[model samples]
Target: MSVEKPEGPGVIAEKLGAWIADVHASALPDRTVEIARLLLLDVTGLCIAGRGESYVRATLQATDPGGACTALGHAGSFSAFDAALINGTAAHGEDYDDTFEGGPVHSGAVVVPAVLAACEREGLGGEALLRGIAVGAELMCRLSLVAPRAIHSAGFHPTAVIGALAAAGGVAAALRLEARQTTSALGIAGSMAAGIIEYLAEGTSTKRMHAGWAAQSGIRAALMARGGFDGPRTVLEGKHGFFKAFAPSRAPDFSPVLETLGESWIMETIAFKPYACGTMTQPYIDCAIALAERGVQAEQIRDIVCEVGEGTVHRLWEELAVKHRPPTAYAAKFSTPFCMAVGFFDRKAGFGQFTEARIHDPAVLALAGKIRYVIDPDNEYPDNFTGHLRATLNDGTVQEVRQPHMRGGAREPLTGAELAQKFVDNAQHGGWNAALADEARGWCETVFGEPALGTIARFRQ
Candidate 1:
């Protein structure tokens, strides 16, 4: 008897393929292209500032010989896939990549590298790259929306998993694949999608590789589809498929995936991080900074009360002790108390503050020791990053501040100028020259006008 085939991953892939083939680069909306440019700027900044990181350096060394693609500060020559694996890892090393609320996926880390790799190999122009980025990001974000909570809570990292299919769609669109081929590529990409949240259990570099793996796997999937390979036709909806197998908690909504493809853009919902820590810790950091500014000295504070929403405490403060004293710099990025303490004392938390030296800083630790977190059952998590802080001084005076929505999120998106400044600051840390950095920024702005990506690919090297 023949085995009945599941069609979920395959069907979603097919529609995605059709979308890519039908959407012409020139037809993309002006606003979407502008959003793509912003994402590129943000990703480029992360890649630059994150280069000096040991994880980035180690990844570069492990995957050397990347051809024509830049790996931040390193000079190496490898295959296009290798370039994606290394550069993508570097971009996400600091967790400074862009985040999407509909889903927690990191778009730029996976999509940008894959598009750049395909553009380099095909000699595609900036317009195609921009369109591909937009399409890829949309697919990734929509997929995230399908079962946002279930997929995330099930211990899967959406950035590394759904992101592969998104990149595949983008590449297929850029290369002008037929609808059938595009669908097949998505099917193939589905089989390759995998990422776990186990990294949160410790500060392992495994998380860094998720984005790289997604980028490389998506590129390979697209290549296979281009070569006439057929993949499952219904990979998203069928029994034992992506939605069912990976996320069984809730039924996914497929409408968003096939919604007004060109008119409604998910890339517009992307949020760039202001802090180098986990997204969950951002609101707390803001609250701490505000409290410190109100003349609350670290020593004078008795018990620093944090009335956090249920979701933040459950996801971010699960292991309260660890959050109080993180063992490594990577672990520090996920520690709410550590991030909050640093923000309270410094008023800013950059890449430098998460270092081992800073993690062990007495002042920050002292401030952290005063923290007492109280979960507010009424406060909903994730719908929005809301936070509350109450500082009780030695004299028994309590001052409180509450933020409904974290800065730099959907409710408070960063301005173009603010994002550009972040990019420049991150690039300067990555060691890019003022002239070269300006040139890079310009290239990203008008990337659509260029005839081919040969220049940009060479720059990645």
Candidate 2:
């Protein structure tokens, strides 16, 4: 018996593919290019910082060492597939990579590693790299908007699932592939897309590898398409399409993805993280720090109350006791109370703040125990992440603080100086000196004009 196919092309894939094919390095806006450059720098630093992490180390151990692609800060070389996986994993291992404010999918962690690996393997140049990153990020951001929180609601990580398509679209644009092949790549990636939210249950390392898996899945899909593999054209909007499979609850609106593909750049709105924790936790960290500044000692606070978005209650505020005292440092990254306590006492939520040693500090845990949340129906999460903290001091005096928005979000972006320091700090955490970190930054700063990624080798130890 023969099987029936969808009648028309997946207009979603076709439109995305055509838009990607038409993008040129020279035609990109200065702001977009700048954002892409910073994204590259940020992800690169994050990869290096995560290289020594246990999860990343385990992933690196699973692969053999002989290929052209480079995994930042590692001496071993790997095939584009393995390298993209390894690098992508490292970039997101710490949950510190760039996040879209519209939702939580991480673009840089998934797209950069895939695009960079493809560029390096195919001998592509910096201009192609920049274009690829921009295209990939744009797609991921728009895709996140398609179903809003529905993906997470359906028990899947949006970045891990949506990232596969974004990476495919990105690499296709970077290499300037035929529009037909780009469509095939997206179709193929739909099959490769996967990652579960079960990691939230145990604080396992699975979430760290999701980005890597998606990255490698993208490379494989794109390569297969380039080699003449054909996939269903209507892979996105078919009877059993991507959204239907992953986000069954919502009816996806493709306008956010297609109508604004090029005219209004979504990548420009990408938010760089100030705190090395979950995206939702960033604003609350600001509130914690503010409370500390107001001379409200941790011990003096009877209990701290926060007005939070209901959507955040699951991954961030659930299992009340567990959220109060997360099992591991990785779990702590998602716990608003833990993040707030550490941010309050440390005055910052950098790499050092999430350490096992710091998380176990009695005072931090005690303060975290006192933190609780009340759901606010009007909270603007999955859109704007705002923070509200109302503290009842020991003397029964109430001190309240409201952080209108996340510090590193579009409204109040990180200064160049701040981003640079983050880069340097991430590099230092991975054992590179300030000088070496500066050199890598210089390369990211100017590689777009260069003929090829010749200096890329300097990143690996």
Candidate 3:
């Protein structure tokens, strides 16, 4: 007689583990492989750009600094775990990494580092590394959908909360673990998953470290599982499992997590940022730039009103006065009013727009002070990040613009040429000489052909 498949919290994890363990590079579509390479290139560029940030420097100081794996943008070598941690932090330090549009999680920041470090330490090949990244990113996006926006509503950073599992999944795939070991790794990682949304309160650096910590923790979990350590099979859907523990109020559906496991690839839906700020704020900045381009000078504006999603208002539009004059450069990046002001005043918002001097610019601050938002109940958030802007000029004229969708998402994905240019620009901003940046670009182009660890090692210098 045929037996029913085992059911429990572990059901999701078990199936996911089996799929991950069995998936080969040959099974992935060409588009998926191409997207994975693009993501790797984008994240590597972001890590290089973040190496000079104060938080990354601080992380370097705190960790033991000698081992075999290369730390991107730094000259030092470190243990696999430490390398993953540092590289993950550097990738996310500026909030510039690729984001999964649905979870709004920076999966690349967590998964890329963990998989890369594991491959380096294990002497794995390039194809395996790419496959691992694809699996990890897909899991991260899927897990985020399990609870929808519940993770954010419950005051948890989705990237950190879901990243641990994603990292573990990626590392397990890279290490070529069996289904049981991979499931165990996912279970162990669930306990390690953590990240509070409290960082939003102070505009602190704690948020940047979440990705790194998750990456390191995943490495630990996978290694422990490989060592024959056992863990709950029903970690994901069990009592006090990830969603229930983190988002107690929201009833999570496992359908999204388990449905179309190998047939559907969620990584393709990931969005690349054209602006280096909060993902939701990107469209608003576009609106502001449009107004500026139409000759609506800052001096001509009386009040700037934004119709925003209630979800965005809490993290980005609240405390109008404080947001108008953010306490720190990093804080300014998350402040919708500040970003709007920068766009109008400078006609652009990028890494250069978030410097201390720019954050404190008198003209920008004055314009930001007049910015305010009203909640739009009909907004498509935690799904579509649409933005609407209305500027009332002193001359009694009004100019309004509404963004139908986020620009870099699946709906309006960036072109290959655009992505290539972004890589070059980010590398230059990170202080790489032209020759070095070009060399890095070449490495990304031929990554599939070279040894994974050796290709990554070129970034060490």
Best by TM-score: 2
Clashing pairs in 2: none
State the lDDT of candidate 2 residue by residue for 189-224, as single tens digits: 999999999998988889999999999898888889
Using Cα atoms with residue i matched to residue i, what is each candidate's TM-score against the true structure?
A: 0.93, 0.98, 0.96
Candidate 2, which segments miss by more than 4 Å at Cα? Answer: 1-10
Candidate numbers sorted by TM-score from highest down: 2, 3, 1
What are the lDDT figures for the candidates, one per model? 0.79, 0.90, 0.86
Question: What TM-score, to 2 decimals, does candidate 3 have?
Answer: 0.96
Better of 1 and 2 by TM-score: 2
Task: Give the per-residue lDDT digits (tens) of candidate 3, residues 1-461.
Answer: 95544565557889989999998887898878887898888988888788788898899988897877978889978999889989899888887788876678988889989988888888887877888889999899989888877888889999998999999999998898999999999999999999997877779988899999999988889999999996677787877788888878789888888889899897888998888888889889889888888877888899988988887777898777789899999999889999999988777777899999998899999999989999989888878888788899998989998888888888899898889888888888889888988888877767766655566777887
In angstroms, how far off is 351's CA in candidate 3? 1.3
Decide which is better by TM-score, 1 or 3: 3
RMSD, every candidate, angstroms:
2.4, 1.3, 2.8
Off by over 4 Å in 1: 1-10, 64-68, 457-461
What is the C-alpha RMSD, rounded to one decimal, of candidate 2? 1.3
Candidate 3 lDDT at 283 equals: 87
